[model samples]
Target: MLTPLFERRIDRMNRGIAEGSLTARLPSGETRVLGGRAAGPAAVIELRSWRAMLRLALDGSSGWYAAWLAGEWASPDPVQLFALFTGNRAALAVEARAMGPSLLAKRVWHWLRRNHRSGSRRNIRFHYDLGNDFYEAWLDSRMNYSSAIFRGAESLEDAQAAKLRAMLERTATAPGDKILEIGCGWGPFVELAAREGRSVHGITLSTEQKAYAETRLSGHAGARFSLTDYRDVTGTYDAVASIEMAEAVGRRYWPDYLAAIARALKPGGHAALQFITYDDAMFEAYAANVDFIQRHVFPGGLLISESAFRALAAENGLLWQDQVNFGASYAETLRQWRERFDAAADADRLPAQFDAKFVDLWRYYLMYCEGGFRGGSIDVVQITLVKD
Candidate 1:
């Protein structure tokens, strides 16, 4: 089955890929050649079966994602494996057909809770509530799940602090200013701000996150954590900050989210927000497809274009004051995380699943995201909006 499929795909690529063919080890431990000339380092795939190959052919990229998640295939180094895919993404995307969801994954996602209060709780729980220990093993000390701002070869820990510090400076939080952080994951930024003598009220939809943050910040004089949605907050603050959480608001609730931020702020308040973004040209395609990230990584989350965000800020009476891009940093961050996750099974932090699915799937997801950043398919930005 792979014979014909590989033949078809390689032929379409027409780049003398046979010279860079991959060695695939089948479930039966038999090896076969696959792929065209790969761009970088050599890699191996522990194939699932001939049927899996057929599924890969019919299902598109998501099919491969599902297969990896099910332990259908593996590569000792996922970066190398993912490189093979990204190197050929252009050719493959050109030939990619409008195949429906490979395994009804999109349908399941469609039925899940969305951006309403209860829905937000469920969505937040689905990801962040996995376990504090699980995240602690990979993320930085403060449990930053978002991208960090690197100042050239700094460790992730330092980068994370720099990221937090940068946000602090940009928002110009005073020693006693009142701040509200929507979707504050584990309260890192809240704690950071509190340590500097600022008062902070952090809202989060994940009960586990609120619980952890509560215990951590209980003694701080000006720190408070709420297991609540952004829309439910009651008080006004001197400033507002939400990092990488806007995506979870969903398209239908974007207005409400923007409004909620506006309502939480006092007059002349400022806002600092960090979000993932896509190019304007791909917004249409992004809206149409419930792609692998939507189906598996961030259900109900949708990326907005930077242009759209600027427009929204203007309409909401916030002047777009500053914007910065550090997408390449995210790729390196993922690389650091993959290294930690790779050692998890050995460290007994997150043991290899019985089927070894979790490790393979996680590695693939990281690299897949890294590929997006590398290919300019996605970006990360920190924007400051002022309401003067």
Candidate 2:
């Protein structure tokens, strides 16, 4: 039965939908249409139980995810719903954010998972150590886990190669220049550098990544992989390339991350970095509460604030340059990945260790991120920071 309090809560959420429309079917066979003020993506949600709304009201995205896990709600196309919420996030404000004890508890738990030296390794392992074979089942041939830059109708593999080339070009390394790749996954960038006759060294906190990278480049005399923390790196390189790794560094360690880059680069050397960023306007609120990604997908992860990150780089004697935003490409990349993942899952190619629930969670994670990029609130960027 639908209670008056739950109905009122649903009404409040509807009022905040400044853009897009949602048609929600309640358990009592009632349908409510919300937010037709403007033309936008329309999504339909079926509420199996009113507790789903209550969960969303109290726990925000994380709670809503829990409700989904419990079969309290269903959506024909969740991507539309996610995009709608993210696109109208500013107008929705606190309506979709955690509150009360849930907020406080999640914040404390997130603090505990901060990316300190040891915690960094643990956190990396939590996501990346799912085994190389597991990722290989779904990822591209190059095993590029980050966003790929698509040009026209090229394949995902070609797009990923283009992204790698783009990042390397930003570094402008000569044939003999030594290149350091921070958070190198599966040796794609390092192998490319080594093939170009550059002395390439790749570092990662994930044991699985380091092992896979080293094995992948075993025949290349100029390529090496190390399990090392960025803060502890102890050498100057002609160029540095860190692809989509900065998000793993928590907000408290932004300075440390920039300082490490500054210390590792030779004078006038360039550091090409690919990082995810939150819209400047929404960063504070996003940081204040634990979102679905932070709570379940990537522990200790926080998206960058471009202004603050650039300021930190400047403070560390690194001049920011050639910033490129390719968030739409990321959305497409994620969509492709999800398609591949679903194919692999249907074929039973995924590892036996990851059960059905884990698979569903992974699917949701990819969808959530894809929608985030599509909505324009979150973005992925490639930028060069030159050492002064």
lDDT by residue for model 1 over 252-339, one digit each (tens)?
Answer: 7887788888888787888989898876665665565566666666677888777877787787778887789998888788888878
Residue 152 in model 2: shift from native, Å?
2.0
Clashing pairs in 2: none
Q: Candidate 2, residue 348: CA error in Å?
A: 0.6
Q: What C-alpha lDDT, on a 0 to 100 scale, does residue 224 get in candidate 1?
A: 91
Q: lDDT for every model?
A: 0.74, 0.91
User: Which residue runs does candidate 1 get wrong by more than 4 Å?
Assistant: 1-6, 14-53, 69-77, 80-91, 94-98, 101-108, 351-355
**Candidate 1, overall lDDT?**
0.74
lDDT of 1 at 3: 67
The 10-residue segment with the lowest total lDDT in model 2: 87-96
Tell me the TM-score of model 1: 0.84
lDDT of 2 by residue, 1-388 (tens): 5588888877876887888899999988999998878877698999999888889889999888889989999999888888888888877657678999999999999999999998898889999999999999999998999999997788999999999999989998989899988899888999888998899989998889888888878998689988889999998999999998999998999999999999999999999999999999989988998988888989999999999999999999999999999998999999999999999999999999999999999999998898788878899999999999
Displacement of residue 75 (Cα, Å) in model 1 is: 4.2
Which regions of candidate 2 fall more than 4 Å away from where they truly are?
Answer: none
